[model samples]
Target: MEKLKPKLFSVMESYNGQQFIKDVTAGIIVAIIALPLSIALAIASGVSPERGLYTAIIAGFLVSFFGGSRVQIGGPTAAFVVIVYGIIQTHGFDGLVIATIMAGIILIAMGFLRFGSLIKFIPYTITTGFTGGIAVGIVAGQIKEFLGLDMGAVPSGFIEKIKIYSESLHTIDLSALLIGAISLGILIFWPKITDKIPGSLIAIIVSVLLVKSLNLQIDTIGSVYGEISASLPSFHIPEADFKTILQLIQPAFTIAILAGIESLLSCVVSDGMIGGKHRSNMELIGQGIGNVFSGLFGGIPATGAIARTAANVKNGGRTPIAGIIHAITLLLILLVLMPLAALIPLSVLAAVLMMVAYNMSGWRQFVELLKTSPKSDIIVLVATFLLTVFFDLVIAIEVGVVLSSFLFMKRMSEVTEVNGWKYVEDLTDEDYINDIENIKYKKVPQNAMVYEISGPMFFAAAHKFIDITVEGKVKKNVLIIRMRSVPSMDVTALRSIQKIHKTCKKQGITLLFAHVQNQPMSVMKKAGFDQLIGLNNFLPHTDDALARAEQLKCS
Candidate 1:
C-alpha cells in the first residue's frame, strides 16, 4: 500500500503558489501541443477525433492524479496506433473497448504483483526494432492521405498497403498534396521560428485556413469523418462473452505489455530529466486505472507519451498538477473549440502523423545497432523489425524474446568452464600469506587434483561441467571440486554434479566439495547429493577441502 501511493500527495505537501502558477502555465502549453496530436493519433487509430480528446482529457487526468511520476503526461501515443487499429479492424469498436478494459485489468495485476521493474527485461534491440517497424507502418498508413489518393479503404497489411498505394498513385489530388507538403514543411521547420507554440498546431491552423479560404477540393475532417462531436463522453460498458474474452486474451496481453513498457520508458526518461525516482509499480496501477476509464468513455488505449512528458518537464512542470491541468485544458477545448477541428484537413493531420512517425522511428539507433552490435543482437533486431512490419507486434515480441534468450544461453554456456587449478604454488608464497598459520597449509597430496568451476551452472552450461569434470578429467586418487565463484546452479547442473560423484564412486576415487555458496548448498541438500557425497566431504574453505582430499589420499 505504501508503494502504491501516488506522487501527487507527497508533492502537494510542499507545493507553493509560484509552483502552482508554473504548473498551470506549463499545463496549458502542453495541452496546446497535445491537441492536434490527439486528433492526428485518433484518426490514425481508426477512431473518431473526439475519442482522442476523450482519452487526453479523461485518461490524462486519471493518470496524473494517481500516477507515480510527477511530470509524466499520459494519453494516446503513436506506439498504440498499429495495435489499436488492428484490434478495431478485427474485433470492432466493442471488441477494442473490451480488450482495452482487459488490458487495463492486466496492468493493474502487474503492478500489484510488483512486475513493473520486470519491464526492463524487454531487450533494447526488440524495442528499437518494433518502434522502427511501427514508424514504417504509420508512414505507410498515411500514404493515402498524404498523397490524397483516390482510395476508399486502406488495407492494414504492410505489403497489401504498398500494392494499394501503387495502384492509386495516378489518382493523387493535387490540392491535398500541396496542403500536406506545406504542412509537413512547416512541421519540420516551424521550431526554428518559435518554441512557444507547437509546430503541429501551427501546421494544422495554416493548412485549414489555406484549404478553407481557397475553397480547394480537399478532404477535411468534417468532409471525411463527419462533424466533430462537442459533447462530453458518456460512460458505457463494452459487451463481452467468454468466447470474446478468450479470443481477445492474446491482444489484450500485448496491449498490457506494450503499455507497461512505454510508460516505464517515459517515466525513466522523465526521471533522468528531473532527477527524481518514480515508483514503477504505482505508475502501472495509474496507467491501468486510466485505461479502464478511457475505454469506458469510448476512448482507445492510452499510456505515457514521452514527447508530452518532455514538453511538460521543459515548460517548468515539476508535479502532477501540470498533467491534471493539461487534461482540464483539453476538456475545455473539447467543450468549446472542437467544432473548429472539423475544418482541419485530414491531409494536414496526416502530415502531423508523418512527423510523428519520423521522430518515433528510432532509425538512428537501428542503424547504429546494425553497425556496431554483435551478430546475434543484430539478428534479433532485424528479425523483430521484419516480423513487426510484415506480420504482427505480438509475433515479433514473442519470437524476439525467445531468440534472445537462446542466444544468451549459448553465450553463457560458452563462458562457463571447469578446469584443473594449477596455481597452488602461487598461493603458497610467504608474501601472499598473512600469517604463519595460513602459510603452513598443506600442499596438494600425491594423485589428488583440484578443479574449479566458474560461472553460473545452469542447464545450458551443465554440459560443460559434465564434459570437463566427468569425461575429460584425469583420473585421481581424490578430487576436490571448488565452487567459490559459482553463484547459482539449476537442477540440471545438480544432476551433472551427481553424475560426477557417481563416476568417482565407480572409479573408487574420493570426491570432495568446497566453498559451496548458500544457494548451491541448499540445492545439494535438497537433492540428497550431500548425503551421497558424505557430510564430512563438504568443506567450508578451499584449504579444508585440500586437507580432506589429502586425508582421503592417505586412507
Candidate 2:
C-alpha cells in the first residue's frame, strides 16, 4: 500500500501559494512548448494532429497525477514515431489503438512484477544505437513534407521511401520549401532571442500567416489531412479478435518496453536535475495507466518526454500540479485555437520535427563511442544502428541483446582459470603464501597435490577446470581440489567435477574437496556429489584437506 503512494502526495505536504505560482508559470510555458511538438509528432506518426493533443491532455494529466517523479511531463515522443507509423501502416487505426491498450496492460504487469530496476540491464550502446536510428527515421519520414514533394503516400520501407523521394525531387514546391527553411531557422535561433517562449510555436504562427496572407500555393494541414477536430475525444474500445490480439502481442511488447525505458530515463534525468529520488515501480504504473487512458481516448502511445520534463524543471516546476496545468493548457488550446491550427503549413511542422531529429539523434555521442569504446561495444552499437535503420526496431533490439549477452559471457570466460597452487607465488599476498609454504613443508605429506579454481565455473569456463584437473599431466597419491576463490558453479561444472572424481578413482588416487562456497556446496549436495565423494573427504581448508589426504594415504 505504501509502495502505491504517488510523489504528488509527498510534495503537497510542503506545498504553498509561492510554489503554486511557480508551477503555474512553468506549466503554461511548457504547455506552449508542447503544443507544436505534439501536433508535429502526430503528423510524423501518420495520424491527425488532434490525436496528439488528446494524448497530451489525457496521458499527460494522468501520468503526472499518479507518477513517481516530481517533475515528469508525459506525452507522445519522437521515439515512438517510427513504431507507431509502422503499426498504422500495417494494422490500421483500430489495430494501433488495440496495440496501445495491450502495451498499457503489459506495462502495468511489469510494474506489479517489480521489473523497473531491470531496465538498467539494457546496455547504453543499444540505447544510443536505436535512438540515432529513430532520429534518422524521423528525418526521413519528414522529408516528403519538408521538401513539399508531390508524391502520394510515402512507402514505409526506408530504402523504398528514399528512392521515391529522389524520384519526386523535380516536383518540390518552392513556396513550401521557403516556408520550411524559415521555420527551421527560427526554431534554431529563437532561443538566442529569448527562452520564455518556444520557437516552434512562433514558427507555426509565422508560417501560417505568411502562406495564408500571401496566398501562396502550399500544402497546409487542412489541405493535406482535411479540417482539424476541436471536440474532445470520446471513450471507445477498439474491436479486436483472438487472432488480432495475438498478432498485436509482439508490437505491444515493443511499445511497453520502449515506453518503460523512455519514461524511466526521463525520471532519472529529472531526479538528477533536482537532487531527488523517484520511485521506479510507481513511475511504470503511472505510465501504464496513462497509456491505457490515452488509448481508450483514441490517442496514440505516450510516455515521459525528456525535453518537456526538462522544461518543467528549468522553469521552477517541482510538483505534479505543473504537469496537470500543462494538460489543462493544451485542453484549452484544443477547444479555442484548434481551428487556427488547420491553416498552419505542413512544411512548418516538418521543419519542427527535423529539429527534433537533430536534437535527439545524439550523433555526437555516436561518433564518440565509435572512436573510444571497445571493439565489442562498437560492434554492438554499429550493428544495432544499422539494423534499426535498414530493418525494424524489433529485430534490432532482439539481436542487440543477444549479441551483448554472448560477448559478456565470452569476456567473463577469459577471466576464469584453473591452475596448480604452486603458481600462488604470483599472488600479491606474499605473506599468506609464505606462511602456507612454510606450513606445507612440515605438514604436507609426500605425493600430495593441491589445485586452485578461481572465478565462476559456468558453462563457458567449465571445460578449463576439467582440462586442468582431469586431463593435466599432474599425478599424485592424493589430490586436494581447493575452491576458496571460486564463487559459484553450474551443472556443467558439477559434471566436470564428477568426471575428475571418476578419473582419480580409476588412477588409484584419493580425491578431496576443500573450502567450497555455499552456492556450490548446495548444488553439490543436491546432486549427491557430496555423498559420492564421501563426507569425510570434504574439508574446510586446503591444509585440512592435506591432513585428510595424509590420513587416507596411511590408512
Candidate 3:
C-alpha cells in the first residue's frame, strides 16, 4: 500500500506558498500548451473539440490529484486517435463511453493486482512497430482535412481511406491547402524562436487570423461542427447491453493497455526530468479514475500526454499541484474562451497533427533497430508494423505478443542441452576443488552410464529430455543423471523425468540423480520422485552417484 500512495499527499507535507506560486505559473503555461492540442486531438479522434477540453479538465484533475507522479499532466494524446475513431465508427459514441469505463475498471484492477511492473515485459520492438504504424495512420486520417479534400464521408480502414483520398484529389481547396502549408511551416520553424509557447497554439492563432482577415473559403471548426459549447460538461451515466459490452471487450482491453503504457512511460520521463521516483501502481489507479470520469462526462479516452507532462516539469512544477492547476486553468478557459476555438481552421489542426505524427513516428529508432536488432526481434517488429497498418491494432498487439513469446521459448529450447557424458578430460589444474575428482579415473561399473542436463527444463525442452533418456537402447543396469547446471524445472519436465524413471524401473535398471538444484529438488520432493526412485539414490554429487550406481550393479 505504501507503494500505491499518491505523490500529492506526500508532497503536501512540504507544500509552501512559494512553491504554490511556481506550480500555478507552470500549470498555466502547460494549460496554454495543452489548449490547441486537446482541440486538435479531439477533432482528429472523430469527436467534438469541446469533449477534448472536458477530458483535459476532468481526467487531468483526477489524475493529478490522485496520481503517483509529481508532475504528470493527463489529457487526450495522439496515440489514442486511431483506436478511438475506430470504436466510435463501429459502436457509436455510447459504445465508446462504455468501452472507456470498462477500460478504466481494467486499469484499476491491474493496479490492485500489482501488474504495473509487468508492463515492462512488453517488448520494445512491438511498441516501436505499432508507434510507427500509428504515426502513419494519423497522417492518413488528417489528409481529408489537411488538403481540404471535398469528399463525401471518408471511409474507415487505412486502405479504404487512401482510396477515397486519391479519388477526391481533384476537390482540394486551394485556400485550405495554403493555410495548412503555412501552419505546418510555422509548427516546424516556430520552435527555433521560442519554446515558452507551443508551436501548435501559434499555428492555430496565425491560421485563424488569416482566415478571418482574408475571409478565406476555408472550413473552420464552426463550419464543420457548428457552435462550440462554452460551458462545463454535464455528467451522464453510460448504458450498454451485455452483448455490446462483450463485443467491445477487445477494444476496451486495448484502451486500458495503451493508457497504462503511455501513462507509465510519461511518469518515467517526468521522473527523470525532475530527479524523482514515481509509484507506478498508484499512477495506474489515478489513470483509471480519470478515464472513468472522463467517459461519464462525454469525453473520449484520456492518458498522460508526454509533451504536456514534460512541459509541466520544465516550467518548475515539482508537485501534483501543477497538474491540478493545469486542469483548473483549462476548465476556466472552457467556461470563458472555448467558443473562440470554433473560429480556428480545421486545416491548421490537421497540420498540427501532421507534425505530431512526425514526432510520434520514431522513424529513426525504427530504422536503427532494423539495422542492429536480431533476426527474431526484427520479425516481431516488422510483423507488428505490417499488421497495424494493413489489419487492426488489436490484431497487431495480440499477434506480436504471441509471436514474441514463441520465439523466446524456441530460443530457450535451443540453448538447453541434454548430453551423455563420456570419459571426463583431465583438467585438474583448471577444475574447482569440488570438481577435482575425474570421472575418467573413477572406477565405474561397466553397466552404469552418466548423462548431464543443462539449462532450464521447461515444457519446450521436456520432450527432448524424454526422447534422449527413455527412447534409447539403454543396456545399463543404472543411470546417473547430472543436473548441477539445471537451474529450473517446470511440471512438464518433471513429468518427463517421472516417465524416464518408470521406464528404467520396468527394465530392472536403477535411476539416480546427482547435484539436483534447489528448484528441481523441491519439485521432485513435492512429487515424491525421491521416494519413488528410492531416497538413497538422490546423491549430492557425481562421485556419490557413481558409488550408488556401483552398489546397485553389485546388488
Candidate 4:
C-alpha cells in the first residue's frame, strides 16, 4: 500500500506552488520562442504548422512527466527537419507515422534492455560529420523556401534536391527573399539588443504587420494551408500494412538514431550545467513514451532540447514542473490564443530555423578539427560530411561506422610489434656489454636460449616481430622465451610466433619457454607445441639456458 503511495507522491512533488509562476513565465517566454520556429520547422519538414505544435504540446508534456532528467525540455526541433522532410516527401506522412511508432517501440525495448549507455560508444567524429551533413542538407532545402521559388514538389535525393534549386534559381520571388533576408538579419543580431523576447517572435510580429499593413505580394500560411487548427491533439493510429511496415523501417531507424544521439547529448550538456547525474535508461524509456504519444497525436518527433533544458536549469527550474508548465502554456495558447499565431509571418519562421542551423553547425570547430586532426580521422569527418550532404543520413551513418572501425583497427595494428633482446638495465655499461674481454653473453653460443610470452598479444604491435625474424638475423642460440609478458593471444599473433618457432626448429636451434603463465602454459600444452619440442628443453632463466647451451655444445 505504501509503495504505491511513493509513486503517486513523486508526481505531486514535481509541482511547487511558489515556482509555478516562475515556471509559467519561463514557459510563456519559451513558447514565444518556440512558436515561429515550430511552424517554420513543420512547413520546412513538409508538414503543416499545427503538427509541430501538436508535438510540442503532446510529446513535450509526456517526456517532462516521465523523463529522468528534470530540466529537459522536449519539442519538434531543427535536428529532425531534414530526415522528416525526406520521409514525408518519399513515403508520405502515414509512412512517417508508422516509422515513428516503430522507432518508439525500438526505443522502449532499448530502455528495458538498458542499452542507453551504449549510445556513448558512437564516436565524436561520426556525430560531428553527420550533424554537419544534416546542417548542410537543411540549408540547401531552405534555399527554395527562403527564396520562394517553385520547386515542383521538391526532390528527396540530395543531388536532385540541389538540381531542382539550381534549375529554378530564375524564379526567385524578391518579396519573399526580402522577408527572409531581413528576418534572418534581425534574428542574427537581435541578441545584442535584448533577449527577454526572442528575435524570431518579434520578427514574426513585425513582418506580419509589414505584410498586412503595406499589402506585400509575398505568400502567407493562410494562402497556402488555409488556416491551422489551433486545438489540442487527438489520438491517431495510422493505417499499417506490409508495404507501410517495410517502407517505415528506414525512417524508423533514422528517427531512432537521431533520438538516441539528441537525448544523450542533451543529458550530457545538462549534467555539466547542474552537476548532477541522470538515469540514461529511464530517460530513454521516457523518450520512448513521449515519442509514442507524439506520433499518436499527429505530432512530429521530439527529443531533449539542450538549449531549452539549459535555460530551464539556469532559471530556477529544479524539478519537472517547468517542463510540464511549458506544455501547459503551449496548450493554453492553442486553446485561447492559437488564432493570433496566424499573424506570425512564414518568412520569419524560416529565418528562425536558419538561425537554428547556424547555431547547431559549429563550422569553426569543424574547420579547426580538419586542420589539426590526423588524416585518417579527417577522412572519416569529410566522408560523413559529404555523404550526409550528397547522399542520405542513413547511408552516411552506415559507411561512417564501417570506416571508423576499420581505421581504428589499422591504427592499433601499426603500434603492435614484438622484439627479442638481451635486456640490460644500465646502458652506460655498454663498454662491458660490447667489450670482448668483459661481455657476459660473449661465451654464449647460438641455438641455446628461448624467450616466450603469453598475454593479450594483438594487432596493435604484431608486424615488427615478423620483420625482425628474417633469415640470417640470428645472434644467439637456445633462446629461452619468457612467456610472462602475455596473458592472452589472438590468432594472428599466435601464427607469427608459431612461424618463428618453426624456423628455429628448422635451423637446428632449440627455442623454449621459461616460467610460462598458467593460462598460456595450458593453452600451448593443449596445442601439442609442448610435446613436439621435447620436454627437457625449457629453462628458468637466460643464465641456465646459456649453461645448457654450453654443456650441449661441448658434449
> Which parts of model 1 have CA positions greater than 4 angstroms off?
422-442, 469-475
Global Cα lDDT for candidate 3: 0.89
After TM-score superposition, what is the CA distance of residue 40 in candidate 2 from its true location, in Å?
0.5
**Candidate 4: residue 297 Cα off by (Å):** 1.5
lDDT of 2 by residue, 218-269 (tens): 9988888888999989999988999999999999999999999999999999
Query: What is candidate 1's lDDT per residue for 116-210, written digit by digit as tens?
Result: 88999999999999999999999989999989999878877899999988998999999999999999999999999988889998898899889
List, residue by residue over 293-397, the lDDT tens digit for candidate 3.
Answer: 999999988999998998888899999999999999999999999888879999999999999999988899999999999999999999999898877788999
Off by over 4 Å in 3: 424-447, 469-475
After TM-score superposition, what is the CA distance of residue 364 in candidate 2 from its true location, in Å? 1.2
Each candidate: what lDDT? Answer: 0.90, 0.90, 0.89, 0.74
lDDT of 2 at 170: 100
Best by TM-score: 1
The per-candidate count of clashes, in order, stands at: 0, 0, 0, 30
The total of clashing pairs for model 1 equals 0
Using lDDT as the yardstick, the better of models 3 and 4 is 3
Q: State model 4's lDDT.
A: 0.74
